[model samples]
Target: MRLALAALVLLLAGPTPSQFAPAQAPAQLRRGLASAEAAIRAAACDAERRFGEGDPDANASRCEGVRGPPGVEVGRTSARLRNPRNAPPGWAKAYLAQTDGKKASEVEPAVFDLGDRVGLLRPIEIRKRCLSCHADRAEVAESTRAWLEAAYPRDQSFGYALGDLRGFWWAEAAK
Candidate 1:
C-alpha cells in the first residue's frame, strides 16, 4: 500500500528535474561532442567532394548526414550569421567576443559549468576551402553568392578571410 501510494504521488507530480537531466559524465560529454564534430566534418567534406567545393547545396548536406549524439545538444553559431536560427545563446556571445581577431589554432575550446549542466565550445576557423563560400562578395563564385542571397536573404556571413575565427561549435550536457 505504501509503494502504491508513492507511485500515485509520483504520477501526479510528474517527472522531477533530475529525471530530465543528462546523466552522462563529463568525459562522455566530451567524447560525444568530438564524435559529432567528426561526423559533421566528414559529411561536409564528402558533400564538398561530390557537389564541388563552395556549393551552398554541399554546405546544406552537412546536416543531412549528421545527428547530435544522444544526451547532448550540439550546434554551430556565428556572430555574423547566415541563418538567424544559429544565433548563439547569451553565455556564448561572451565567448564569441573573446575570439575576435584570434585564429582557430590560437584559441582553445571553452568549458562552462552551468550549475546543472556543462557546456563546451570549440572555435570554427575559416580555411582556404571555406573562402569559396564565405569570402567577400566579389571573391565568391557569383552563382554561390546568388544562391546564398536567395536562401539566406539577410546573410551577413561573408567577408571572412582565411585563418579568421568563423564561429563556434558548442555542446551542452546535463552534469
Candidate 2:
C-alpha cells in the first residue's frame, strides 16, 4: 500500500528530475533587466525634475539606484531585491553598442528560468534629448556642440528621429 501511495504521489507531481531539470535563468534575467530599466527611467525623470528639459547639466549626473523596494543597491538596480548584482556581461555590451551618443537611454531587464539568473533587457533610446547635445549644426547649441567636439572627437551618436531604438541591454547568466 505504501509503495502504491508513493507511486501515486510521483505521478501527480508530474515530470521527474531526470525528465526536467528546472530552468530559472531566463526569469531571473528578465526581473533584473526590468528593474534596471525602471531605475534608468526614474533617474531620467528625476534629472529632468531637478534640472529642466534640455538642460545639459543632467547629462553628466548619475544617481545611485535601488533595485527592489525601499531602494537597495546591493546588486539590483532598484530599491527592491536584497541581492541584486551587476548586469550580465552581454547585456552591458549590447547597451553600450546602442548608446550611439544619444541624450539618454534605458535598458530593460531579462531573466532565465534555468537557475533564476538575471540579465539585461533591451535599451530604450531617449529620442528628444539628443537634440541638445547631438543635434545638427543649426539645431544644437554652440556651447554644447563645442563641448562634444572637444570631448568626443569622433562622436557619431547624434541625428536621430523620435521613437528610434538606440540601444538594448544584453546579458548571459549561469544556468
Candidate 3:
C-alpha cells in the first residue's frame, strides 16, 4: 500500500529533469533545422510556381506537403501572422525579440533546452519567389489574394520585400 501511494505521488508530481535525455548537440540540432528549412522553402517555392501556372488549388497544397525529419516537429512563425495557429510560443517569442535589427543571415539558429525536449529556431528570409503570396497587397496576383482572403481572413503576413526577415522556422525534438 505504501509503495502504491508513493508511486501515485510521484506520478502526480510530473516528469523530472532526470527523466529526460540530454539535449542534442548544437551541431546536430542546427543540421536538422537546416534540412527542415530547406524542405519548407522548396515547398513554398513549388506552391508559388504552381499558383503562377493558374492552378487555383496550388496556393498552399505544396507547402502543406512538407515534412520534417523523424522525431522532430517543425513549424513557422511570424510577428505578422497569416494563420493565428502559427503564433510563436513563449520561448520562440523570447528568441525572436533578440533578433530585432538583424538580417536573417546575420542571425544564428537559437537552441533552447526545454526540460523534456530541445528547440531550435532559425530566421527565414523573404526571397523573390516568396513575393507571390507575401509581398505588398497590390503586388500579389488577384487570384492569390482572393484565395488568401478566403483561407485566412485575418492574414497579416504581407508587405515583405526581398531579403527581409519573413519569420522563423522552428524545430523541436526529444532531448
Candidate 4:
C-alpha cells in the first residue's frame, strides 16, 4: 500500500514531458494563427462598423487607442494602417501584391519572421458597404470626405470598390 501511495504521488508530482511539449509546431502555429486572426477581425470590424468609415474620432480610436489583439498589431498597408510601426512585413507585402480582392479574406494566414519576431498576416478586403466611405472622392459623403481630409492630411485609403483590398490584420507573436 505504501509503494502504491508513493507511485501515485510520483505520478501526480508534475506534468509529463509530452504534456510540457504540447502539440507539434505546425499545429500550434495553425491554432495560434486562427485565434489571432479571429481576434483581429473582431476588433477591426467593431471599429469599422462603429465608425461607419467616416468618424475621425472612431477611426483614430482604433488606430491609436487600440494597439491590437494581445500580441497582434493590426493596421492597413496603405495610409490606412498609417503608422510606420504597423507596416506589414516584407513577405506580407509580396503576398499582398499577389492576393486579389476575392482571395483577400481567403488567403492562407502566412507566417513570417519579421526579424523582431514571428507574425501572421490575415488579409482583409473592403465589402460593398465599406465602399460608401472608402470609395472615390466623388462617391464619399461630403461630411465624411471633410472628416477624412481633416483627420488624415495625407490619406490614401480611398478610391476602393467593393471587394478591393483595404489592408491586412497582422498579429505579431514572440519567436
Q: How close is candidate 4 to the true structure, as a TM-score?
A: 0.57
Candidate 3 matches the true fold with a TM-score of 0.61
Residue 139 of model 1 has an lDDT of 94
Cα displacement (Å) at residue 30, model 2: 5.8
Q: Model 4 over residues 1-175: C-alpha lDDT tens digits?
A: 9999978865765432111111233554555555555557667766675755455565554455443346655555632542456665554555555564443445555665444344566556678777767898899999988987887766766778776667777665543
- Ranking under TM-score, best-scoring first? 1, 3, 4, 2
Error of 4 at 87 (Å): 3.6
lDDT of 4 at 64: 59
lDDT by residue for model 2 (1-175), tens: 9999979966775542111111333343445545544544554445455655555455445443422322312221211111224333422332344444443323333332323333334444545664575355567788877887787665654565565444433333332
lDDT of 1 by residue, 1-175 (tens): 9999979966775443211122343553554445545544554455456646446565665555554446666677887899999888655666676676677788776766555566666678887888988999999999999999999999988888999888887666665
Compared with the true structure, what per-residue lDDT tens digits does model 3 show for residues 1-175?
Answer: 9999979966765543221112444553445445545554554465466645565566556555655457667677877789999988665775566664456777766666565566666678887778999999999999999999999999988888878787887766664
Alpha carbon lDDT of residue 64, candidate 3? Answer: 57
RMSD of each: 12.5, 15.3, 10.7, 16.9
- Clashing pairs in model 3? none
Among residues 3 or more apart in sequence or in different chains, the pairs in candidate 1 whose N, CA or C atoms overlap within 3 Å are none
Ranking by lDDT: 1, 3, 4, 2
Kindly state the number of residue pairs that clash in model 2: 56
Q: Tell me the whole-model lDDT of each prediction, alpha carbons only.
A: 0.68, 0.43, 0.68, 0.58
Error of 1 at 2 (Å): 62
